[model samples]
Target: MLEFFNDTQTIHFIIIVGSMSLFFIGFYGIATQKNLVKILVSFDIMESALFLFFIGLHYKVGLVAPILDKHLKTFTNMVDPVPQAMILTTIVIGLAVLALGLSFGIEYYKLTGRNDISKMNELRD
Candidate 1:
């Protein structure tokens, strides 16, 4: 039983399920919340779920980071670098988008003194 938990496949499954739950939680928050800030928080949560799933899916047991050293002369059993690189790039982009979204929210709040989506219909004009 202990060995089953120790297996990479089992760990991946757990991670997937956990992330999926988080995704649903985020979706619920986005769907039910009326506050703009809460919606943004939910969006972040959803983004985090995707990141968790991607990282978990790429993880392998007993694999080392993709770094070159004398002790690690071969690529065998080394973690793939592509996903890490892609995720790092994605994180930067995500931050930029989040910052832009927050700035928009701040501007909207400043202009109308409201942070609820229902009250921001004036934005259409």
Candidate 2:
């Protein structure tokens, strides 16, 4: 089992496992749960998973960030910066979406006087 602790392959394995677990948990929360707040939270979890997967795939030990400094003229096995930038955008978008979704959920609860989806569907009558 000690061999599994090696970074050459274990890091990627962990990244995959983490991503899969996140997806499963998020899916379950979104599909089986009826609470709007929970669904939003699940969405947030999914976003986190994607970000983790990306960062993990691009990560490398003893590497520096792509920030340009007067001292560090060139990169030394630095990981890709594109993924980091994309993840940043994704994170911001996720926050905005979660904020919007939660506010909508709150409004929904206020208008209907209930947070349960089943109880809110009496409008057809």
Candidate 3:
């Protein structure tokens, strides 16, 4: 059990499975939820799952952060910083999009006095 838990492959497998599960949960929520807020939340959940999958997959067991110092001058053993940076940028963009979506939802709710997707027929004309 100890050996199994300590294996890098096992860790990666767990991350992949966990992220996939989260993504599907989000997808299910989006598919079944009638409320606009719930759908937006589901979208956020899916985004989070993708972020987790990317970051988790890029991680290595024995790698250090990509930093330069006297003790570690080379970039050889350091973990790749590109994925982390990309995830950070993605997080910012995701937040902006989520905020925009929520603002639209709020406006729609204000105009219609309801937040249910099924009842949103204002744009059907």
Candidate 4:
């Protein structure tokens, strides 16, 4: 059992499965929840899952970080930094969007006295 857990392939598989499950959990929340705050949280969960999936899958057991140094001077044998950078940028953007969404939700709740998506009919003609 320990040996099974020690394999690199098994670790990668676990990461993939875990992230996918997390994404679906978030999707389920978005599909079924009626509260504005809950929906926004669900979206955030999905974003986190994607970040985990991207970063986890790109990692290798032996590859070094993509940093230049005297001993490690080449890009060879180093993990690709593109995915890490992209995920970092995505995380920043996601946080901004999440904050904006939550603020909007708060304002909506303040104006309407409710945050349920189905109850938001103030704009109906």
lDDT of each: 0.89, 0.82, 0.92, 0.90
Better of 2 and 3 by TM-score: 3
User: In candidate 3, what are the lDDT values of residues 10-100, reduced to their tens digit?
Assistant: 9999999999999999999999999999999999999999999999998888988888888987789877899999999999999899999
Model 4 per-residue lDDT tens digits across residues 1-125: 58888777988999999999999999999999998888988999999999999988888878888899899877898777999999989999988998999999889878879988988787899
Models sorted by lDDT, best on top: 3, 4, 1, 2
Please provide, for model 2 over 1-125, each residue's C-alpha lDDT reduced to its tens digit, 9 standing for 90 to 100.
67666674777888899898998899888888887777778888887888899988887655778887998887766789999999999888888888888888888877777787756666687
lDDT of 2: 0.82
lDDT of 1 by residue, 1-125 (tens): 58888889899999989999999999999999998889989999998999888888888898888887988787788887887888889989998999999999999899989888876677485
TM-score of 4: 0.88
Runs in model 2 lying further than 4 Å from the true structure: 1-4, 69-71, 122-125
Which candidate achieves the best TM-score against the true structure?
A: 3
CA-RMSD of model 1: 1.6
- TM-score of model 1 relative to the true fold? 0.91
Better by lDDT, candidate 3 or 1: 3
